[model samples]
Target chain A: MGRTWTLIRRRLLQAIPVILIVSIGIFGLLELAGGDAVDAYLAVTGGGDPAFAERLRQQWGLDAGLWVRFLAYVESLVTLDFGWSVVMSKPVSVAILERLPNTALMMGAAIAFSACLGTLLGGIAALRKGTAADAGITVGALVLNAMPSFWIGLIAIVVFAVKLAWFPLGGIASFDRPDLAIGRVLDVAWHLVLPVTVLGLAYMALYVRLMRSAMIETAASDWVRAARARGLPRLRIVRRHMARPALLPVVTMLGLQAGNLLGGSVVVETVFAIPGLGSLAYDAVSQRDLPLIAGILLVGTLMVIVVNLLVDITYARLDPRVTDDRVRAGGA
Target chain B: MLKVRDLAIRFAGRSASEAGTLAVDGIDLDLDRAQVLALIGESGSGKSATMLALAGLLPKSAKTTGSVLLDDRSILHLDEREKSTVRGRRIGMIFQDPGGSLNPVLTVGDQIDEVVRTHRRLDRRAARAETVSLLSRVGIGDPAARARAYPHQLSGGLKQRVAIAAALAAQPTVILADEPTTALDATVQAQILDLLVNLVQVEHVALLLVTHDLAVAAAVADRIAVMYAGKIVERRGPEQLVTDPGHPYSRALGQAALPFVAAGDGRHAALPELPGRMAEAGGTACAFAPRCPLAIDRCRAQVPPVVPFGDGEAACFRAGETAQ
Candidate 1:
């Protein structure tokens, strides 16, 4: 437990610098792109007076040099204040927080769904290695990975929503739900079925393949062989001996694919009509809303850091060697 | 007691007629309670294969035939469930590569406790108690604390001790130790081997120690079986096997290994070397004939029959001949 805490502390400290660098990078890149909310607003109006545009830019501090504006943005961020969203006419934080639950619910369910099912199928493939079952799983996972996320989402929506009419076309929920808490929860869950399936399928194949290869490699280790020699039952060996080590790679991939999952959401959320970070970022980018995009990037980057920290914590818990003083000292 | 009769194993996935598939082709061995039988051979010589067969630890692709009798019951013919019950309970295992031979994530105590809980009908607390005691018996100091330590925390010697402790957790009737001390330092190696020998004597368990070093085999094993080209070429009492090897390959192995044991001075003579590669398995000729210094025209044409030599057996037509 002490070791776990130490790891968490170290990882948290490491994430601080990364977060700052990413903020600076996003700020610089957006600055270099030569646009702001004022330009976007002027475009909507078909034209504007030069003084009026200058005043609008001055109000938002976009007229200031890069360093001055960046320092102000950083100051506000330090106090948890994301700048105002000109497009939404609200604080960027408020607008993002409003839709966060929907996205969180969808992403959480997708990760859980893919990880659980992928681990199960992968274990089966390893146990049935060199057989028809293994080959089918290996190839099927490859095929799933090969297809684009949008394609999978489209097909899922068509089959489950358009044809079967089992789920809604797309959205967070329907209007007909009872006012009861469980009813609202169930309604949201019901609406989430297609989106989660589509999102989960996008990464499930990669998870399956990673997990399959990790388990096969783990099963080949001398310890696994020693477990069998100890006369442990086959299932016991697979579950207790092989599974934990095999899970390390899967967890690592989950962290590695965090960016990909966020990228995947751009398509899945748009198709499902869920106003998550992906759609939020897409709108922010197109409308040239710098503060809102910065807020979204902050959230996305933080999420990746959190995911990696979780991976580190898990590695420490799963593998005791990770906590050794030499390893902790970064002695390779 | 363990009695193996005409034990033959062929690797799975490879066809029966495929070359290199028959890893152990028709070998017989015997070990009684409290005796150690060392199966010594070079790499690819089927000693490890023989150990795997005894424990029923071979992979699904390994096709084992013939009968391996433990007491009176046939081990080879047992179903998977029965094999599990008999293994770990009746026969413990100590593998080579002490560092990697134990589960890396698990604490040493947990590894042993699992075997105890599996083989014996013990509760978790009782099994844990047994684990600590087993560790002490394997010569680990501060056994209680050591039990909680993971494999990575321990030195190579201590890891091997933990492995030995795990093997002894279930009070097995037989132990299959495959080069158990190969990875340890010389001093630590001696201690591990001593502990293994002490276990066989104190616990009255039959032990089969597999290694490639004939000197190590001769040091502790009551009897040494010299394997060559996937077959046992000679089995003799250690003293006789070392000083007067019956088979030509055993003699070569003895020559290669004897310098460390016999030569008192630091400077050593050049060791005699075997001349040729091992023959492929599916032939009607002696596997060692090509490498045998005493090989004759007849040796390459026929499989040498097993003949009594110095109270043991050797499968060589000119087993004792000194020169070509």
Candidate 2:
């Protein structure tokens, strides 16, 4: 456990510069793009005088040089200030905090759905390799991989939500719910079903392939061969000896795909009309809401870095040799 | 005792005639308690296949035709589950590389404990006790502490000891060591081989040792069988085979075997080397005839018949004839 913390602490420290560079990169790119709070405001309302735009730029410190503005932004970050969102007319932190949970909840559900069902399918495919079931699952994941999240979400909404009327069309909850808090939770889940499915399909497809190949390769490994020679029951061999080690690759892929999954949610969230960070990020981009965009990027980067840290911890747990290797490399 | 009669193994190809390699052709052997029979051969010679065949460990593509009587029960045709019951309980198997043979994530103790609990049906506490004791029996120090260590944490010799411990957990009557010391260094190799030899004697387990190294086999085996192209060319006591092999292939193997040179033979002399590699199995005539120096037209026209030479047999038409 102490080893895990040490690893996490080192990774987090390493992430500090990466996070700063990403934030500054975004800030610099926005500066180079010749956009500020005033241009975005004028782009929306139109007919703003040059003097008014200048006043607003100066007020927001957008008129400062890139480094000077970035320094101010970093200093504010120390006090947990992400600047004010000219588009949302609120503090950037407040705007992001309000929607962070929604995106987290959606992504958490999607990952949960993918990890469970994907592993199950991949395991079946691997165990019964070269069979019809393996071909069917492999083909199915391929089909899912080819489709876009928006297309999947549209199809799902058309089928399950609109045609069958089993779920609400979109949003976080049924506004006219006359039941208790538990009913609201159920309504939220019902609303979530389509969006989560859409967001999860691509990653689920990825995991299916990863886990299948991993399990196939892992089953062929020397230890698995040893397990079989020991007369371990076939299921026990698959579960403990094969699948457990096979999970390492899948876990690594989870961390690597965290950012991609969040990026995917932008389309899925907009399609389903969920009030999550992704949809917010979409609006933030169109309005050139630099503070809000920068805020989301920082948070997104941190989430990905943290997820990777968790993956490292999981990797160590699943394969103890990883810990020993790290120690051998002088606590690297 | 484990009696194997007319054991043969053939692997099917993608199609009917793509490969059809007879990996282990018809062979017969007897293994009694406390005896070591080493099947020595080169790579692709089917010596390893013979051991894997007895354990029913060959994949589905390989066709095995044999009668394996394990403690008087015919087990050649048994299903996987049924064979598993006989595998760990009646015939234990140790692979060449101990580190590879043990699961990396699991502690060596748990690995041994799993086998003990599986066959013995012992509860956790009792199984753990047996595991530690077995570890100690295999010459591991601080058995309790060592039990908690994973395969990666232990040295090569220690890992081999753990592999031996796992093999001996069920008190199997027959133990198959498939080049059990090949992956270790010279010093560790000898230590593991000695441990296996000692265990076979003390535990009274029938050992079917497989190796490509005739010297290693000669050092430990009571009887040695030299296989060429999926067929055992000669079977005899290790000493006799090393000194005066009946089959030409056995004689070549004896000369080729390293580190166990005959007492009177000049080690520095130009040793006559065997020509060519092992042939792919499946042919009408003698498999070794192409490489055998004593091959005549008849040796090529027909498969050599097993001829009795002293107390053992050699599958050579020219058996008992001295080769120039």
Look at candidate 1 and give me any clashing residue pairs: B12-B61
lDDT of 2 by residue, A80-170 (tens): 7888887788999999999998999998898888877898899999999999999999999889989887888888889998899988889
Off by over 4 Å in 2: A65-67, A177-179, A327-332, B17-19, B258-267, B279-284
Q: Write model 2 residue lDDT over B7-86, tens digit each, in one string.
A: 89988878986867888888888889999999998889988888888887888888889788877889788898898887
Could you tell me the TM-score of candidate 1?
Answer: 0.93
- Evaluate all candidate structures by whole-model CA lDDT and list the values in order: 0.85, 0.85
**Candidate 1 lDDT, A1-332, residue by residue in tens:** 76677777777878899999999999889988887888889888797999999998888778888778879989988998998998888999998998777877888788889888888889899889999999998788778878887888889889989999899989888867679999999999998999898888768887788788888898999999888888887878999788888888888788888778888888899988888888988889888998899999999888888878887787778878777862468433
DockQ of each: 0.78, 0.68
Return the top candidate by TM-score.
Answer: 2
lDDT of 1 by residue, B1-324 (tens): 699988888886456556437789888889999999999999888888889888887777788888898988898867789998788888999988998878888898988899998888899999989888888888889999999999988999999988888788778899999999888899999988888888899989999999998878988999888888778888899988877778988888887988655455766867767786877665788888778768888888999988999968898998677874
Candidate 2 contains a number of clashing pairs equal to 0
